[model samples]
Target: MSVTAPRGFRAAGVAAGIKADGARDVAVVINDGPSRAAAAVFTRNRVKAAPVLWSEQVAKGGRVRAVLLNSGGANACTGAPGFADAHTTAERTADALGDSAAEILVCSTGLIGERLPMPELLAGVDTSVAAAARDGGLDAADAIRTTDSVAKISFRRGDGYTVGGMAKGAGMLAPALATMLAVVTTDADLTAEQCDRLLRAATAASFDRIDADGCLSTNDTVVLMASGASGTTPDEEAFAALLAEVCDDLSRQMIADAEGATKSIAIEVVRAADEDDALEAARAVARNNLFKCAMYGEDPNWGRVLAAVGTTSAAFEPDQIDVAINGVWVCRKGGVGEDRSRVDLTGRDVTVTVDLSAGGASATVWTTDLTNEYVHENSAYSS
Candidate 1:
C-alpha cells in the first residue's frame, strides 16, 4: 500500500499516452478528508519546472485536496507556455474534484527542456479522478516512474494513525531532495503548521541525506497531506519519527534502484564537531566519483575516502581522521591500519565509517557506486 493506505485518501493511476510505450504515466491522489492540511518541499535547484513553481504556491496556501502527477515529460525550461500548461493542469484537476484551483498541487517528472502533452495528460487526470479508489495506492505508485525499474512505497502504523507514502526515482538523486516525486498521507489530526514543520524535519533526516549521483532534478517534490480521518491527535514527536521512517524507507529504495548501480553504500560520519559537520563530511565522500568508482570495483580504497574528506571544510584533523570499510579499520589516524585487501566490497551493500573524532554528533549519507552502465544509460537519456 502507498498513499491511500492512510485513511481519507483515494488514488488512481492510468495509461495516459504521454510515454511512447503507453505505460501508466499519470496519477492522482485526493484527500477526501475532514481536514486537508498539507505541506510540501521542492527542489532547491534554481531551475525549477513549471509544475514546481505552481505547486510551491499551492503549498503556501497550506491546504490541498488533490495532487496531479505526470511522468513522461518535464515541463521545464519551456517559459510562459509551460507555466500555463501547469496552471491548466491544476485547474482541470480542481474542476473534476469540485475544489478551488489553489487547493490542487501538480507535479511532473521526466526529460527536461520539453513541454507536456496537455491533451493526453489532462484526459488522464480526468480518467484517474473518476477511477480513484482506496485500494489504488499501488497503481498510483506505479504510474510515477521513468527510469525506475520498480515502484517504491512504504507505510507505518502509529498508536492511532498511519503514514503511507510512494516515491519514484532511479537517477539524479541528490541532497535537498532527489530526482523524485513523493506523496505521503497521514490520518492523524494535524494543523497545517505542524504538517509543515514535521515534513521538513523528516525530509532533512531522510531524503536530504541521500546523494545517489549528486545531480539535482528540477522536478523533485515531496508532499505530506494530513486528512485527520483517524480522529487521533498523535504525539508530535512520535508522528515525526514514524514519518521519518517512511521517508527513509523510500529513500533507501531509491538508492537500491538507482540507475546502473550495483552497490548501495552508506557513508556514516561519527564523532564530528556537529551534526552539520558530519553531514558535510559524509556528503563529500558520497558525491565523490572516485570513491563511487572504487566501490564499484570492490576496492576498499581508503585513500579515495580521505581525499574526498580533505575537500570539505568540516572540522577535522588530517592525521586524526579514521576510516573503516565493512567493519575493517582500513585507515586509522589517517594512516594504514588493517590491510585494505582485508575489507570486502563484493556485496551489494557497503558501509563506510568515517570517525571525525571531533565531537559526538554524527550523520549518514546514502549513495551508489558509479558504473559503466550508469554512464551508458545517461548518455542516451534524452533520446
Candidate 2:
C-alpha cells in the first residue's frame, strides 16, 4: 500500500552507490494521468533545501507528472550549485520519461550540509526510471528512509476512488510540518483547488500535530497528486474525511516506527475554551522533553504534564484542570485524584488526556517518548 496503490501511477527504487552500504537511495514516481493536478506543503524552515526550493516553484503550477527522490544527501545550504543539481535532476528525469522538465518535482533527505554525488545520483535516476512499475511503491518507500526503522504506507478507499501514500520520518519531527518526505496519490477526480485544501486540512490534523524531537528539517515536503483516473468526483466533505483518515494512518505508522522510540504517545486535550486553546495545550505537552522522558520510564509523573500545560495561555485555571494517563485519572481539579501507581505504561502505546474544564473543545497530538537510543542515533547519524 503506497502511492502506487492508486491508479495511473508507477514507482521504483534503486541503489546508486550513494549510501556507503549500497542500500537503495533513489526513487522515481510517475503519474500516467488524464489530469495531473497536484498540491504540496514544504517545511516552514527558513533555511530550505535545494529540492524544496525547486519543488516550491513546481507545485505552484498545481501539476506534477513525475517525482524523483533520494535519501543519501540533503542538498541544503549548498548555494546555487545545489539548486542547479536539483534542476539537472528534474531535467534528467523528464528526459527519461519523455515529459517536460517543468512537470517533474525533486526531493532529497540526509545529512544537511554536503553536496549530492551528481554522477552517481544521475545514474541512479536512470536506473530508477527504467525499473518503474505499478507494484514498485514499496521499493520507493524503502528508498526514501533515513534513520527510520520502517517504511510507512497507507491506503483509503472512497466510493469509486482510492487514496494511497508513502512516508519516511523518524527523527527531527516537529510542528513546522515535521521532518519527513511524503507522497500521496489519488485516482479521484478533483481540481487543483480541492487538492490544496484537502492536503492542508489533512496535514494540519496529522503531520503538523506530531513533535518527536521538536527539530525542523530543511528538506521536509509532502505532495498530493490527483490523476483523475477513477473518473468519480466525490463530495468535498467525504473526500476530505477520507484524506484525513489516510493521513492519520500514516502519522500513526510514523510514530510507531520512530527512531529509537520505545513508546508511541497520544496527547489529547479536552474541555478547552476553544479549538485553538485545545490545540496549543496539546502541542505544549507533546513537545515537552521532560514529560517525554518521564513517559519513557513509565513514571506517572503528572506534574510534568501540568507544568507543560501551564506554560500555554489556554484560558485554564490551575485548580480546574484534570489529567488522566491510560484511562486512569491521576490528577483532578489540579490535585491528585487517583493513585498514580494504578496507571500502567507497560505497552508500547500510551495515551495522556487533559481536561481544561473550560469548554468542550478538544484536540490530539501524537508524539514519541525520549530515550537514550534516540540520543545515540542522532549522535551517530552522520557517521
Candidate 3:
C-alpha cells in the first residue's frame, strides 16, 4: 500500500531561536474543515511538561483543531510560569488559526528545567502558520526533533484514507511509553473514543515494548488526531487495524534510531503461560544491557537470555527452556546446543527467540544494542 498523508491538514516549521544549533524550533499543524476528533497518551512521569498537563486537560474533551509544538525547551519543572508559557504558545497558534485556545494542543521537547523564550516562540508560531501548506508536513516533522539524527515519519493509505505521523526521541526511552514525542494525523472518520481505543491497543504492542536503557522520560507524549476529511468512513475494525499498523511502523523507527544504537533487536517469547507472562519475559530481555551488548558484539550468550527470563515472573522450568539467536539454535533444553561461534551480528538487525515450554501464549518486543557511545553521549548531555 502506498503511504500518504490525508488532505485537509497543513503543516509548517520555522526557527525561532529556541535551539543554539539554529534548527527549526517550532511547528504548527492545522486541520482545515471537518476537524475530526483527537486522543492522546502521555508520560506517567510525575514531573510532566507544562504543555503535557495543558494538552491532557484539553484532550479530555476530544476536539482539537491544531497542535503547536516547540523543540529545545522541555518546559518542565518551571511551575506556574511554565504553564503560562504553554498557554501563551497555544493561544498564539489559536489566534493565528482563528480557533479557540482550548482547541489547540501543545507539545514541547528538549533540555529540561528551562523556561521557553516566549518572544522567539511567538515569532515562530506566526511564521509557521503563514507558511502552512499540505506538503509542509515533513518540515513540521523536522522541527520537533532534538538529538535525533533523522526525523521519523510514517504514513499509510487504506480504504480511501490515510494516516501520517512524526516522532522524535534519542534517549531516556523505555517501555510503558518510550521517551518519545509524536503527532499523528488521519483523514479517517473515527470518534474520539475509537481513536483512543485504537491508540492504546497499538501502543501496548509497539511503543510499550521498546526499551533503550530501561529509563522512561518525563515528556513522552503521543497525540493522534482524525480530521475526517476523506468523506469515507471505515468500520471500527478496519480503522483499528490501520491505526495499529501506523503505530507499529513508527515504533520500529524509534527503535532503529536509538541513541548510539548499532543494531535493532527483536525479542520474541513463546510458549508462555499467558500473554502477560510472555510480555514480561520479553521486556526483561529487552532491558538487559548485557544481553544487548552481547548481541552487538555478535556473541551468542544464551545465558544472558536465560538470566533475564529467570528474573521475570513468567513461569518456566530452566531445564525446559529453549533459545535461539538470529535463527541459530544456540541453546536447547536449557543447555548450549549449537556452536556459539556460528552466530553473526555483522548486520543491523538481530532477533532472539525464547520458548518457555509452559503454555501457548507469545509476545514480541523491539530494542536496540547498548554501546560505549551511548554512555559517552549521555554522560555529557548536560554540558
Say which candidate scores most in lDDT. 1
lDDT of every predicted structure (CA atoms): 0.92, 0.89, 0.83
TM-score of each: 0.98, 0.97, 0.95
TM-score quality measure for candidate 2: 0.97
lDDT of 1 by residue, 32-80 (tens): 9999999999999999999999999999989999999998888888899
Candidate 1's error at 361, in angstroms? Answer: 0.6
lDDT score, candidate 3: 0.83
lDDT, candidate 1, at 167: 96
Off by over 4 Å in 3: 1-4, 171-178
Ranking of all candidate structures by their TM-score, best first: 1, 2, 3
Candidate 1 ranges with C-alpha deviation above 4 Å: 172-178
Give the per-residue lDDT digits (tens) of candidate 3, residues 57-125: 988888888888888888887899999999999999988988799988999887677888999999999
> Model 2 residue 36 lDDT?
94
